[model samples]
Target: MRNIKIVIEYDGTKYKGWQRLGDSDNTVQHKIETVLSKMAGENIEITASGRTDAGVHATNQVANFRIDAEMPTHKMRSYCYEYLPDDIVVKTVEEVDLNFHARYNAKVKKYVYNICNNKAHNVFNRKYEYHIPQPLNVEKMRKAAGYLIGEHDFQSFTTLKTKKKSTVRNIYTINIVNEDGNVEISIQGNGFMKNMVRLIVGTLVEVGLGERPADGINDILDKKERKYSGHIAPAKGLFLEEVNY
Candidate 1:
């Protein structure tokens, strides 16, 4: 058996999410697996670096699958591109070590949240960016993000219903940048719990909008309480940008 690794890009607006839901077929993984199974004449299961929430996009999402077929990796990639929807594309494919696992081998994942910080929304990017009518103080947002850069218990920034035993994560960086009317908050971390990135963005948004103090993140980190953090940002604005191995 040969293990194939693929780099993919997808606009998650039309699908439920990346993972296959048993009840629903509208998922990126299900779609890709179906196409691969048809080509290989066997059931093919692909493992991703991580799951992106519904309506969240990805630029370089990585996945690996093993197949007994002797087809070249490029042919397999082409076959997927030929069958998958236009919104999903397999950018590159290559053979890898048999034991290479996408999720387990991931060292760092980078996520970016886009915000339209103007009075009126940009029609061109309505589906991709979050529109915030209220003015934002980018400087304040940057300052608040600094408090989240180190390792800490991120229980306050994730769903309280998570089944994971540990909520601790190390954030390598959190950068807030503004260009024109678009504000991008990019974060790199070792791992994330469910809704953690969106919740962190929401908390920073509150600080940018003057609803919370610039140092509010410190308080949230110290308290480790979900109630103190801002609401979870909408899923549409978040993107799984890169996964570093």
Candidate 2:
């Protein structure tokens, strides 16, 4: 078997999510798998580095699968480009070592969230960005994000209620930039649970809106309760930017 690694870019507005459900074909994974399986003349199952919520986009999501076919990697990639829908694109495909598992071998992931802090929304960007009519304090958001850096038990920031798995994750950095009326926040972390990025962004947004103080982030982390965190940010504003192995 040949282990192939593929990098994918997708505009996930229409899909239910990344994973394929038993009852529905409206998923990114199912869409790609259907095309690849046809090309390989066999059922193909690709393992992604992580899952993105519905409406969340991705610039460089990574995945890998083992194939028994003798087709060239470039040909396989070309087949995907021709068969997959316009919204999903396979950026690159290369043969990888047998030990390089997409999910287990991933070292870091970077997610970017965009907010249009303008009084009115831009027609072109309305689909991709979150609009906040009121002005935001970008500095406050940055200050609040500082408290979330480093390793922490992020139980409060995730929606996964089951405590059987570890909630501890190492957040390497949080970079917030404000340009004109656009506020972009980039978070680099070791790993994240379900809805973790959106929840963290929501907490920072509360601070930016003056609804919560920057110092309150530490208290939220200490509470270790999902209710203590702010509202979940809209899925449209979130993007999986990169996955580093």
Candidate 3:
């Protein structure tokens, strides 16, 4: 079996997310795997670097699958490009070492949240960006994000109810940049739990809006409760920007 890696970019506006949900075929993974299975005359399972939420976009999502076939990597890429939905595109495909596991080998993952902090939303990006028609205190949001930079248990920020798994994660960096009413919060982390990024963004947005104090971040972390965190931001505003191996 040869391990093949592929970089994928998708709008994710119409699909149900990245992971296949049992017999339901409304996921990106199911679509890609189904097409690959047809081309290779066998079942094809792919492991992605991360599973994104519904309506979230991805500029460069990574996945790898093992197949026993003589098909060239370029042909495989072409097949995906031709058969996959128009919203999903395969950016690159190449054979990799057998040990290259997409999810386990990922060193860092970057997710960016886009906010239209203006009176009027940009019609071109309305589907991908969240519109908040109010002036946001960017400096305050930055201050709140500082509290999340190091390793800590993020139990307060995630909606995951399973207590068996660890909620501890390390955040490498969190950058908030605003340009002409466009706000982008880019977070690089070792790993993110379910709804963790969206929850963090929501909490920071409250700080930016003066609804919550920046120093209150400490209490939220200390409490380690989901109710202490802010609302989970909308899925359309988030993007899986990159994954580093």
Candidate 4:
């Protein structure tokens, strides 16, 4: 058997998320696995670098799986592309060592939340960007984001239904960039709790709208109370940008 790693990009507008759910009808994983199993002529399981929530897109999601076929690694991309849907594409494929588990070996994951701050939405970007009509205070948003960088217990920023035992995670960077009526919040971390990025973005939006003081972010972190934070932003705005190993 040979282990293969693949870089994937997908539009999550219609799917149920990345994982293969028993009861759910469609998923990114299930779509890819269906094509892969047909090509390999056997049952195959694909593991992702991370599990993105429903409606969350990905630009460089990675996954790995093993197969008994001796096909050349370079040809694997062509084979999968022929069978996969238009919204999902295999960017690259490479043979890797057996021990290269995509999830456990991931060193860092980078995500970006995009907001279209203009009065009118662009029809071209409707599916990818979130439209927020209110004007935002960029400086205040930056200040709030500054407090989120570094290691902290992010229970307050995550959903209450999170199943992870430990809520402690290290955030290497949180950058808020505003350019020409577009606001992008990029966050890089070792790992993230469920809905953590969306919640963080929501809190910063409150700060940008002057509803929450810039310093309130620090207080919220200290309190570790979910109720003190802002609402979770829509998943359509979030994108898994890349995974570093």
Candidate 5:
């Protein structure tokens, strides 16, 4: 068997999420698997580096699957492009080592959240960005984000109630870029719990809106409770930017 790795990009507007749902067929994973399974003439299962919630876009989502077919990687990629929806595209495909597991070998993941900071919403990117009409204190938001960088238990940021084996994650960097009427929050981390990045963005939004203080992030981390964090930001604004191995 040959392990094939593919880099994918998807709009995620019409799909439920990356993972397949039992009751729903509108999922990115199911869509790709169906086409690949048909090509391989067998049931095919692909493992993604991580899952993106519904309405979240992805620019460089990575996944790998083993196929018995000896078709050229480029041919497989062309087949995917021919069969997949217009919104989802297989960007690159290559034969990989059998030991390369996308999820287990991921070293870093980068996510970006886009915000429209003007009173007027961006009609072109409305479905891809979050609209915040109120003026945000960008400097304050940056200050709050500074406290979140480094290794720490992020239980307070995730909505999951069940205990994870380890909530501790190392955030390598958090960048907040403010342009004219637009803001982008980019975060790079080793790993993330469910809703962790969105929750961090929500807390920073509160700081930017003056609802929460910049220094309050420290207290929230110490508490390790979800209620102490701000609201979960909308999923539409988030994008899976890259996965580094």
Candidate 6:
């Protein structure tokens, strides 16, 4: 058997998420697995780098599966793309050593949240960005984001529904960039809890709107109370940018 690594990009507007569920009718992983299973003429299980929440998109999501067939890695993309749906595209595929596991080998993950700060939401971009009409103080948001850029117990930033045993994670970078009427926040980290990025963005939005002081972010972290933090931003704004191994 050979381990096959596939890079995928998808518009997560229609699917249920990355992971395959028994009851769910649609999922990115299910679609890819179905296509690969048919192509290989056997049951094939695919594993992703991580699970993205519903409505969250991805530009470079990685996954790996083992296949008994001997096919050229360069031709794998063409074969999968021909069978996969339009919403999810297999960007590239490579045959790697059997020991290279997608999820276990991931070292860093980068996520980007897009905000449309305009009076009127663009119909074209509505599916991809979170539209916030109120003007945001980008400088204040930047200041608030700095507080989250280190190892911390991010209990305040995660959803109460998260079942993860550990909430502590290391955030290597939090970058906010404003161009025209769009604000993009890019976060790089070792791992993240459920809703962590959305909650962090929501808290920063509150700070940008002057509802929460920039320095208040530190207090929230110290409090470790989810109720004290801002609301979870919409999942559509979040994108899995890249996965580093």
Please state every model's RMSD to the true fold in angstroms. 1.2, 0.8, 0.8, 1.3, 0.9, 1.4
Error of 5 at 37 (Å): 0.5
Q: What ranges in model 4 sit over 4 Å off?
A: 160-164
Give one clash count per candidate, in the order shown. 0, 0, 0, 0, 0, 0
Candidate 5 residue lDDT tens string, 1-245:
99989999999898889985477889999999999999989999999998888888999999999999989999999999999999999999999999999999999999999999999999998998989999999999999999999999898999867874788999999999999979999999999888999999999999999999999999999999999999999988999999999
Off by over 4 Å in 2: 20-22
**Model 5: runs farther than 4 Å from truth?**
none
Candidate 3: worst 10 consecutive residues by lDDT? 19-28
User: Scored by Cα lDDT, where does model 3 land?
Assistant: 0.94
Pull out the clashing pairs in model 3: none
> lDDT tens digits, residues 1-245, model 3?
99999999998898888984566688888889999999999999999998997788899999999999999999999998999989999999999999999999999999999999999999999999989999999999999999999999999999989899999999999999999999999999999999999999999999999999999998999999999999999999999999999
lDDT per residue as tens, model 4, 148-236: 88999887988856555888899999888889989999999999877899999988988998999998877898887788889899889
Per-residue lDDT tens digits for candidate 6, residues 8-85, read 999998888887446785888888989898888889999899988889999999999999987787777888878888
lDDT of each model, Cα atoms only? 0.92, 0.94, 0.94, 0.90, 0.94, 0.91
- Worst ten in a row by lDDT for model 5: 158-167
Q: lDDT per residue, candidate 2, 112-218, as tens digits?
A: 99999999998999989999999999999999999999999999999998979999999999999999999999999999999999999999999999999999999
Among residues 3 or more apart in sequence or in different chains, the pairs in candidate 5 whose N, CA or C atoms overlap within 3 Å are: none
Off by over 4 Å in 1: 20-22
